[model samples]
Target: MTVRKATDVFSEWALRDRDEGMEEGHAKSVNDMLKMVIPKFTSPFSVIDVGCGNGWVCRYLESIENCYKAVGVDGSKEMILKAKIKGDGEFHLAQLPFWKPSIKFDLIHSMEFLYYLHDPFEMLKIFYEEWLKPGGILIAGIDHYSENTISLGWPKALNVNMSTFSENEWRKAMLDAGFIDVKIQRVGIKEGFVGTLAMLGQKLN
Candidate 1:
């Protein structure tokens, strides 16, 4: 059996129009993450959505009156192309844990993305130090984690590498990555589904 790269699989999803379905599937969890986050930005804010599959979140962020900038970055070429075609905000083609943005943002978001990396905390460190401004917030959501139980087979199913750490481990990893005041919240649970485990952290001022 051959293990496949997550981005390559997602690029195919982009070509097949599966990205829209992914947006729909993750919408509830995404909304829950935003509900807690949006209130923090009393003034104008800028955001970057890592692993932005098709820029849906980027467009939504741009629609908010207080959002000065909304940028979407993804490793998949097809996904970025599709995002650009959708036409709402700036979209960049870049791989995580390696590609750093030219500027930082007030808020950084990643959903169901970090686990794909060999060292997810390496990307978290970058998110804390390079991707976010001082006093910035980082929100990372992952569905595949230990204790979730249902998600344990995701790596094998998708043929992609995923770091299956427990919830506490994720929080500790965030703290280890230099994110202060780290917290985790579970949201959007339904029948037979364990809600998304959203890790919230703040870059120290």
Candidate 2:
């Protein structure tokens, strides 16, 4: 599916179901992303959440002890509106693959968002160069990874364009995008769910 159509479908879903539209499995992935990074914030930090549905993650980050600022960017206007209504943070409506942040953040976090892009690697490069400050961390959680057999049919099942790759491929993409110390992890498994593949990398000076 083209970016336009995908955005429309997601926006419609958000308008209809609000936060509950996000699947429980995907919600766990977001929580895993948060748990993995929250302890890393030793000092006050700024964050930009990519594909931040309902801005719940941003709100959670803002509630952290050293979170100086939390901002959410999403392609769905209705999602942003819902976020603005109940979330405590700055929210912006912008397409993930084209969205650019004016201010670089200490951390760039994305959950279940990278695969929707036509070129996930290109998006990683953008986050590395344009959205993250030097030494900043970029963490992404993906449930539709290639290694997860249960999600192999996600593209056809969800009727969306998704790019699936091995965990190693994801780590390499981040490294190629100028991130150092790239790493990957599998987190939170339960019945009928394969869990989330989390990829992390940090911009180097």
Candidate 2 residues 123-143, lDDT tens each? Answer: 998888888988899889888
lDDT of 1 by residue, 102-186 (tens): 9999999888898989999888888888889999999989999998998998888888888899999998999999988888989
Report every candidate's CA lDDT. 0.91, 0.83
Q: All predictions: root-mean-square deviation over Cα? A: 0.9, 1.9
lDDT of 2: 0.83
RMSD of 1: 0.9
The count of backbone overlaps in candidate 1 is: 0
Query: What's the TM-score of every candidate structure?
Result: 0.97, 0.92
